[model samples]
Target: MALTTLFPPESTATPFATFATETAATPFATFALSSTEAAATPSSTIAPYATALNGVNQPMNILFRNAIWWGLGVLAMLILIIRLMQRAIAHSRHTAAMGLSGEAQAYWSKNRYSTWWKFKRHMLYAPLGKKRHNREIRLSSAGNIGTIPSRFHAILLTIFFLSNLAFLAFLDYSRSDRYSVLADLRGRSGVLAIINMIALIIFAGRNNPLIPLLQISFDTYNLMHRWVGRVVVLEVVLHTMAWAIVKHAATGWSGIWHMVGTNPFISWGTVGTVALVLILILSLSPIRHAFYETFLAVHIILAFIAILGTWIHCEVAKLPQLAIIKAVFILWLLERVARMARLGYLNYSLKGKAWTSATVTAMPGGASRVTLHLPRHVNVKPGSHAYIRFAGIKYWESHPFSIAWVEHKPIHEETLPRQEKETPVEKQLREPETTTDISFVIHAQTGMTKTLYEKATQCQPRQLTLNAAFEGPYGGHHSLDSYGHVVLFAGSSGITHQIPFVQHLIQGYNDGTVATRRITLIWIIRESEHLEWVREWMDLVLKMPKRREILQVKLYVTRPKNPRDIISPSSTVQMSAGRPKIGYILREEVKAQMGAMCVTVCGPGGLADNVREVVREVQDVSVVDFIEESFTW
Candidate 1:
C-alpha cells in the first residue's frame, strides 16, 4: 500500500510516524522520506550511501553560500575604489578648469587615452545589442516585454548563473545506486534555494544597504532583484522535481500523490511549490505591466503563503534548511517594521499628532502639482527623490517622485512668543525658524496618478488639499559639482529632477564653490503649455545671480499650437519648434567642451536611450560621462 493508504486523508497521525512507516515499506522512498533513523534530518531521506554523502554536501552548501557573499563584497569594493580614484584624478583639474579662458577650455577638452575607456564603451555603457536597452521592446502599442539589462549586468548575471550550475554539478557521481545521487541532488538544490531566498529579500528592500554601499542606483538593484528571484524559483522547481522522481521510482504515481496528501510537511512543500509557479507566470512583463496594482496585491499574498508553507515544511521535518527559512522570515519582518516606524515619525508630529499635509493643483498639462507642508525643516539635496503617500487616494500606496522645489518658510519673531523684549533688529539677527514646503510635479498616466488628476479637477480652481505623508529623501548619491561642463536633458515632467540641480549649480557658480563653468538645460515637451508647469520656478531660476553668464536653456516643442508660441524668452533661453538633434548638439558642445564634461538625462526611456547612445559614441572623441535617472519598479 502507498503511504496515504495507511490512514484516511484527514488522519491526524504525526508526520514522524507516517514518514517513518513509509521509509520502512519502500526502500526507494528512503530518498524522499528519510529512514526512521533520519526523522532528525531535514528535507531529504537518507539511503545507505546518503549517510556518507550528506556529511560532505551540507558543509559544501555553507561554503558556497559564503562564496556568493564574498564575490559581492569584492565587486562592491572594486566600484568604491574606482570612484575614489576618479575623484583624486579630477581634484586638481577641477580647480584649474574653472579659471581657464575659452581658448584654454578647448585645450583641456582634448581626448586623453585611457585603456579603461574601452570597458566603459563596450561593457559598462553598452546595450545588450546595437542600441535597445533602456527603451522597452514593445509587441504593439501597449505591450511591454521590459527593457534589457546592460552588458555588464548581463555578464555578471551569466557568471552567477553558471556558478550555480557548477556548484550543483560539484558532486561525486560514483555511487552504484542512482537514488543516492538524486537524494544528494535534492539536498544541494534545497540549500541553494533557501540561501538565494535571503538574497532575494535583501535586493528587494527599499532600504537595500547595497545601493549606498556600492554607489549603485536603486534601478540597478531592482534589476538584480528580478533575476535573483528567478534563480530562487528555478532552484525550488529543481528541488521539487528531484523529490517527485525518487518518490515515483519507489511506489509509482499513486505513492507520490499519497505522500503529498497524507503528510503535513509534504503538503506544505507542494503548496509552496505551486504558489511559486503561479508567481512566475503572473510576474511576466505583460501581465505585470498591464495590471500592476492587481499584480502587486496578488503577488504579495502568494509570496507570503509560499514563505509560510515552506517555513512550516522545514520546521515539521526538522530540516537543516529551517534556519535559513527563519533568517528569511526575520529579515523580511525587520524591513517592514523599520518602514512602519519611519513613516510614523516622519508623518505625524509627536506633540499634537498633526500629520503632514498636501495641496494638489491641476497644472496646465495632464499633470498635477503636489505641494507638501512639513512641520520641520528637511535639507533636500539635488538629485534626491521622496516617496509620497497621499490619503483619500491609494492611501496604502506610496509612489516615488522627484522633489522639484523646496522652500523653507521661517517664522518671524512677530508671530513667535515674546519671552523677553527685543528690538526688531535684534530679533532679525536671531536664527531663522524652519517650517518647510516641498513640491512634486506628477504626470497623470495610470491608476493613482489618473485618479489624483480627476479628483483635483473636480474641485473649484482645479485644486484640492488632502492629508498626505512622505517617506524619504532617498537617492542623490551622485554629484556633478566637479565637472567643468554639464548638460541636462529633460522630457516633459523630467524637468522636476533637473530643476533642483540647476538652482544648486547656479548658486554655487555665483559663490565660486563648484568647479562648474558652463551648464545647459535641454527640455523637450509635446506642447508649449507645459512651460506653464514650471514657469514660476524657471522664472526664479532665470533671475539667479550670474545665470545669464553661465547657463543656457533650450526648449524643444515636438508639437505646438503655433510656431510663434515656441519663441525664445531671452537670449540665454532659446526655443525650437521640432526635436533637437541629439548627435549634432553633443558634437557642437564637445568642440567647446570644458574639462571633464558630464551628460545627464532624466526622461522617458526613448529620450534617455538616445542621449545615452550619443554620450557613448562621443566618449572616445571627448571625455563625456553619462548618467541616467531611472526608477523602474
Candidate 2:
C-alpha cells in the first residue's frame, strides 16, 4: 500500500499536505506507508471511517471559529443590555423623585433598591483592589505604568483571553495526520487574529459608536483595546510559527527563506507579523509613558504599515480575512475623519474670519489659564475636556485639558454716538454679536504645558493671545443633576473638573431644573495663592442668586505659609489649613444625606483613591454613588 492510498492528503491547497503528497512516489515513502497502513487499518472497512473522520474535522474547525466570534458578540450584547437596563432604572427613579421633597424625598432616597446598587458597587463599579481604580501604579516617581483595570474589566478580559486560548488548544487533532492538524491550526489562528483585529480597531477608536450606546467610558475602551491588541499579536505570532515549523521540517530552512524571499504573500505576512511584534515592544507601559509624543507618532506610523502589510498579504494570498482587514481600515478611517471634522467645526471661523483666538494667562502657581474665544456658541457640559493645539508652540502636539469655564460674551460691542442727536433707528439696529469663551487651567508639568507656561510668563503682563485650535468637548456628559446631594473633591489643578460641575448644579438649583439641593465643593491646594487660578470664576459663582443657600465651599491649604493666612471671608465659604480627613467628611455628609448622594473626585491619584475608599465604605449605609474623573491616558 502507498502512503497516499492509506493516509490521503486532507486538501491539495494545504501547503504541508501538498508538499508531502507530491513526494509520496519517492522510494522512501513505501516502507513507512506500509507499516502505518498495517498498524492503523488492517481492514478495507476502516477506510470509510477514516474518510468520515477527515470530513468531520473540517466542519469542527469551522464550528470552533464560528463559536469564538459568536461568543464575543454575545458578551458585548450582554454588556449593552445590562447598561440599558441600568439607564432605564435610573431614568424611572429620576422621574419619580421630580416633585417629592423632605420626608417623601428621603423615603425615595433610601436603599430600598439595594440589590442592583449593591451589585454595581461590588462588581461593575468596584476597583480590582481596595479603591485603586484610575490610580496609576508607578514603579518610580519618573515612570507611570498606568492603572489596573476594575474588577469587571479584569473578569471580562480574562474570559476573552481564555476563550482564544481554549479555541487554539482544544481542536480535535486526534484522527488527522500531523500535516493536516498543523494546517488546520494555522488557518484557525490566522482567522482568529484577523477577527480580533476588528475588536482592537473598534475599541481603540475615539469615535467608537459603542461608547455612547453602551455608556462605557473611553478609558474602559482603551483598556480593552490594549488587551485585545495583545491577543491579536499573540495569534499572529502563533500563526507565523506554525507555518514556519512545518515548512522548515518539510523543505529545510533554505526553502523557508527562499519562499519568504520569492513569495509576495509570505513576504507581506512576515512584514505584518514583524510590525505587530515591534508594536508590542514599543507599547510597554514605561516606554509608552516616557516618550508619549514620540511613541504616538511611531505607533501611528507602524500601525499603518502593519495594516497595509496585512491587507496586501491577504490580497496576495486570496484569503477571506480580507473582509475583516477592510473593516479595520474602514473603522480607522471613519474615526480619523470624525476627529478632523470635529476639529474644523469647533475651531474654524466662519465666512473667512480670523481663526479662533486663545489668551494664555500665566498664573501665580506655575500654571497657564488658556481662554479660547470660539467662533460660535457651544453648550458646555461639566467635566468635559478638549484637546487643545497651540500652533505657535508646537503644531503637532495637542494636550487634553479639562474645561474649567465656558461663557458667552458679545463679540462686537454697540456704542452710542457721543452726540445726543443719535437716531432711534441706529440705536435699534445695533446689536452685539455673541461668541463663546472656553477656558482651561493647565498646570505646568513636562513637555507642552511647561513650554506654554514659560511662553505666557515671558510677556510683560504675563499673558499672551495667539491663534489656537481645539477638538471636542469630550466626556463631561456625566450628570449630577439627578442627585439631591452632590460632593465634589478637587486637588490642586484638578479643581478645573469640579468648578463647572459646581456652577452647573448651582445654576440648575436656581432654575429648579435639577434635583440637587445641597452642593459641597472641597478644594485642596498647596498654597493660598493657587486660589487665584479661578478667583474671578469663583466670585461669579459666589455672587449668583441664591448661591449661598445651596453651595458650601471648603478650601484646604495643605502647605499654608501661615495658619493666619487661612481666613474665612464668609460663613458659607470656609478656609482651613492642612489636608482634609476624607473619611470624616464623607461620614458627616452621609449623616445628613438628602437623596441619592453622588461623590465625585477629580484630583491626584492618592486623593481620588482615598475618596473612593471612603465612598465604598459608606455605600451600604446610604444611597451613595462614586464618580471618579481621572484621565489615566
Candidate 3:
C-alpha cells in the first residue's frame, strides 16, 4: 500500500509543515495516512510542534506548549505567595513596633539574623551587577540609553529566554531533508512567537489589572513588556530564517522570490517580520529618547501594522494560532477603549460641570508647577503619579508626573449664603467631605515640559491656565508606614514623589495610625532657587501637629551661588552646600538602628545606584528594605 502524507502533498498552506516521506516511524506519524485510508481532510493545516524522534508515533507539541503556560502560572503563584508573606511580616513588625515601650524600641534594634533575611536583601532586591542598576548609562551629559535590571528581574528573564531556546531544538536531528527538521523549527518558533504576543500586549498597557493584583509597579510591567517584545522579535526572525533556509534548499532564490511575490501567506508574513524589525531597531535607548514623541507615535502605528499583517498571514492559512493573535488584538483594543472611557469619566463630570482645568506657573528654576482641579473628588495616595494631557500643547501626548500634593474639600450639603440668616446650630448637621486638590511640580528638560515652561513664562505673572486630562494615581504600592525608621532621598525634581509620603506619615503619626517614629527627608537639588518649588507645602508640613518630634529635612544644594544661602531653616530642616554623601547618611541612619528601617530613593540614576550600593552594604547590620523608583521606556 502506498503511504500518503496526512496533508495534501502540494498543500502550501501547511502552517510551515513540510514532509517528503510518510512513514510509521516518523515524528509526525500520529497524523500519517495511507493510500487506501479513510477520508478527505481540510485543505489548510497547521502542524506546528515537536514530537518524539526514532520510534515516536504521536505529536506531543501541544502538551509541551500547554506545559510552558502551566509552568509560568505556577511561577506566578509562587511569587504571589512570597509577596503576601512579606506584607504579612511587615504588618506584624509595624504593629509590634507601634506597641513597643520606650525600652522595647532599643531592645528590638538588634534584629536576629536569619538566612531568609539575608537572601531577601542580597538577592531578591539586589542590583543586577556591581551597583549600576537604576542609574541610566549615559552617552553624554544630554541623555542615557537605558538602565540594567535588578538581580531578581534579570534571573527570571534569563530563565524564560533560555527555555525558549531549548524549545526550538526539541525535534529529531537524525532525519534529513526527507523529513525536514528546519520546517519543524520554523513551526515551533512561529507558535512560540504568537503565543508570547498575548503577554506582550498585556504588559504594554497602562491599565493592566495585574499591576494591582500582583502588587507590582508599572515600572516592572514596562520592563517585562520590553523583554517579552525582544523575545518575540527574535523568535519571529528565527522562524523566517528557518523557512527561507529550507525553501532555499528545495528551490533557488528566484523560485523563493516567485512564491513570496505570489503567495499571500508568505508575503504577509514577511511584512509582519519587517515591521517588527523596524520597531526593534528604532526602539533602542538613544533613538527613542532623542525623539520620544516621534518614537512613541511610530511605535504604536508600526505595532498595529505588524499585528494586522500577522493576523492576515495566519488567517489566510487557517492556522489555529490565529486564535491567539485574535486574543492579542482584542486585548489591545479593550485596553485602549478602557483608557478612553476612564479619561472621559475623570476629566468630564457627568453632572454638567466644566472639564478639568489646569493652572501652570513658571517657577524660579526651569520648572513649571501644574495645579489641576478635577471636576470631582479624587483619592490621591502617597507616591502616586498621573499622566497629564495638556489640551493646547501637544494634546495627543501625555507625560507622567508624581503628584506632589493632594487636598480634599467638602462640597457640603448646606452652603452658607453671603448674608447668612440661618442659626449656627442648624449648620452643624452637615455631611463629611472627601479630600481634594491635586498638584505636580514638573522640571523642564525637553519636549512637552520645555514648551510648557516657555508658554508659562510668556503669560502674565508667569502662569498660564488651560484645559487638561488626567489618567492615574498609579505606583503608590509601596508603603513606608510599616517601618519604624524611614529615609527618603530625592534628587532634583524627584522631590515630587517624596512630598506626599512625608505628609501622610506625619499625619499618620499624629493620628496614631502608623508605626513611623522617625522620618528623614534628604533632598538634593542643583541650585538654592529650586527651594521655591515646595516652599508652601514644606511650610504646611513643618506646622503639622508634633512635626519636630518625628520629622527632619536635610537640603543639599549642589550649586549654591553663595555660602550664606545654604543656611538651616530651623532645628529640624537644615541646608548644606554640595552633593550629599549617600553612604555616610545611610550608615549613620543604620547605626542609630530604629526598629526595621526602610530606605527609599527616587532620583538621578547615579544617586539611586549610590543609595542602592550603601543599602546593600549595610543590610547585615539592620533589617533594611531598599526601594528604588526609576521609570524607563
Number of the top candidate by TM-score?
Answer: 3
Worst 10 residues of 1 by lDDT: 46-55
Q: TM-score of predicted model 1?
A: 0.87
TM-score list, all predictions: 0.87, 0.87, 0.88
Cα lDDT tens digits, model 1, 1-633, are 554343223233343343332113344344333332233243333222222123234445556767777877787788889877776666766676656643465645656666656677887888888787788878988887788888889998998799888877765466445665665677677778888888788877778777776668888877887888788888889878777776677557896788789778778988988888888889888888888778878887888888898898888776667878998888888877888887887677655446889999998888999999876656788888998888899887778899999876554536544664442232333333545689999999778999999999999999999999988778887777767789999988999999999998888787776778789999999999999888889999998879998899999999998888878878989999999999999888887787678899998888888888888887788778888896455
lDDT of each: 0.77, 0.77, 0.77
Candidate 3 wrongly placed segments (more than 4 Å):
1-60, 101-103, 106-110, 411-435
* Candidate 1 deviant stretches above 4 angstroms: 1-56, 87-113, 411-432
Structure candidate 3, residue pairs in collision: 135-605, 407-436, 408-435, 408-436
Candidate 2 lDDT by residue in tens digits, 436-475: 7899999998888999999999998999889999887877
Ranking by TM-score: 3, 2, 1
Query: Compared with the true structure, what per-residue lDDT tens digits does model 3 show for residues 1-633?
Result: 222364333243332332223232533454343111112113112221111111121143454567678877898788789889888988887777776532356645555757866886678778887777877878897777888888989998998898888877675555423224555567678888988898899989888887776778888888888898999999999888877765665455875686678878788888899989999998888988888888989999999989998999888766657788989999999998998888988887766365888999999989999998887667777889999999889999989999998865444534433455343322433323322468999999888999999999999999999999998877788888877788999998999999999999988887787778888899999999998998889898998889998888999999888878888988899999999998899898887767778888988888988988888788677678878777555
Which residues of candidate 2, in runs, are more than 4 Å off?
Answer: 1-65, 414-433
Point out the worst 10-residue segment of candidate 3 by lDDT.
Answer: 49-58
